[model samples]
Target: MKVNIYYGGRGLIEDPTLYVINKIQDVLKEIRVNVGRYNLYEQKNGISMLPNTFKEADAVILAVSMEWYGVGGLMQTFLDSCWLYADKQRIKDIYMFPVVVATANGERKAVEDLRGAWELLGGRVCEGICTYVSNRIEFETNQVYASIIEKKAEEIYRIVSHKAPMLPNSINSCHVEIPSAGIELTPQESEQLSVYVADDSFVKKQKEDVEMLSQMYKSILGKKSQPDSEDDLLKKLEKAFNPKEASFKAVFSINLNDVNKTIVLDIDDGKLKSSYSSSAKADITVNAGKDVMSKITTGKTTFQGAFMSGLITAKGRLDLMRMFDRVFVFEY
Candidate 1:
């Protein structure tokens, strides 16, 4: 039998989950079960591609270390990838056992979440391990804990080898029966889509392609393209300037539907300037789509207000961006 162990921990030296899995692996090895271990932290960049590893496994151990809260982000991401990419037919046959080692509370909750996620993906969830180990030294050295890990490994081997049968679960029943809005995509297609979605450049390129196609359609329909009004926007920006006591440089990345480009707003030396730039560096990166820009242009909303309302998304040096509305008073 071939079993895969996915360790969703930071690989800390003192992690109890790591210790438990190591012991379990030893027992599984002694039983002559082919075991493959994947440390999620080491494969963080290629996590979306990891689901392909499930092709050959008879069973999988979804191991996680709950330090303070629930299972960490790495584990959650792996499960999301599985849902998107793993072949549902293949997953339905494979068995999953969740092993959660908790440093704080919520070990039971994390295990339930892992089990539910696998079952919802049409996989069979087997009996698994859950424990709390506050003291690493005692937990690692305790023979009782070691024995428990070994026994659990044997139990998993028996279940997988025998193709154990389990009773129906209400959660799986509800999830399968309920209708959810989603496009039907093959595992390979879903994997490709997930990878593309995670890639900023690829998504931007797709948007540019779509915009180009839209413009072409408009031109074919005898609609004349609007003349560039970059100068008008710059003039309004200049007139709206209200210099503050403090001086700082800020760059704004603005996206407008009228133009298939990013407009940069550079503020320095009490002067406001606007230009089209793709590689411009900024202290604060702001994304104002066409609608948000309209609100700003009509003086119906402030930058801060737009951001708070989720109309605008900003990253990096946000405190500096907070001063944007103070320095630029838009005229209605």
Candidate 2:
């Protein structure tokens, strides 16, 4: 069996919590158990990444000193990190024993807080050691207190060896609701990200990069989704007009099928006049989709080529129909 102790006290000379955990550790180790201890104050820089140590632990002793009111900041940070980075399945299998030593009042409340946190974390919680020791030296020197500590440690060993079950309570039923983040990670990736988060320099550099990217994106202007005007057909017609030297006279009704627009072109003596009209009489009526008209006007295809490809149909004289391309030739 393996048990790990997490000491969150500030290592003060007058801290009685340290003495209790040390005595407990000694009793547990006397039974030939693999034991380890992590002092949070010594490794404060990487506290966020400490949950990775839970992989091999069968049980954990969360020992904290209550100098003031609540559990210390170090222990709270460690618990927050476990909630963020620890594997939920692994946590469900590990047992937690809380030890809260109080110099002031509120020892019972702090113990309840510790157990509540462990229950919320989906871990099994065993009965813990909570006491008010105003005089550290007296608490440490009392033979009766030492015997009680040793017996509790042996009880911890028996609980683990027997694989005791945790009773289901409302606190255990309440699920942990983690806040949403930008990206999701697997267990391994979450551990790695926690390490990065624990490093001040890494987090600072990442924030700087993100700010730069945000400004870069804000400075760029993208094209609008909708066009500003709806006069593309007329504009193309006006731009593609090419006057002829010969004297020619013709009236052409060009109907754009898709757009439901008809363009009437009147050609007389090498001059051209255009108008949009629903009723127009012409020597030739050309019918085509707007795409075909755009292709012909843009010099991509000619009238004769389009007619042979069945892209356009005309209802008038073929001679005048062939003359349609001559007066309105487009340059590249």
Per-model TM-score versus the true fold: 0.54, 0.55
What local distance difference test score does each model get? Answer: 0.74, 0.76
Give residue 44's error in model 2 in angstroms: 0.7
Candidate 1 global TM-score: 0.54
How would you encode candidate 1's per-residue C-alpha lDDT over 192-303 as one tens digit per residue?
A: 6544323345435645755664454344335333333665665666778787844666777666544666777788887777777754587666676654565565466677
- By summed lDDT, the worst window of 10 consecutive residues in model 2 runs over 221-230
RMSD of 2: 33.0
**Model 1 misplacement above 4 A:** 174-332
Each prediction's RMSD over C-alphas, in Å, is: 21.1, 33.0
List pairs with backbone clashes in candidate 1: none
Among the numbered candidates, top TM-score falls to: 2
Quick one: how many clashes does candidate 2 have?
0
Lowest summed lDDT window (length 10), candidate 1:
219-228
Error of 2 at 78 (Å): 0.3
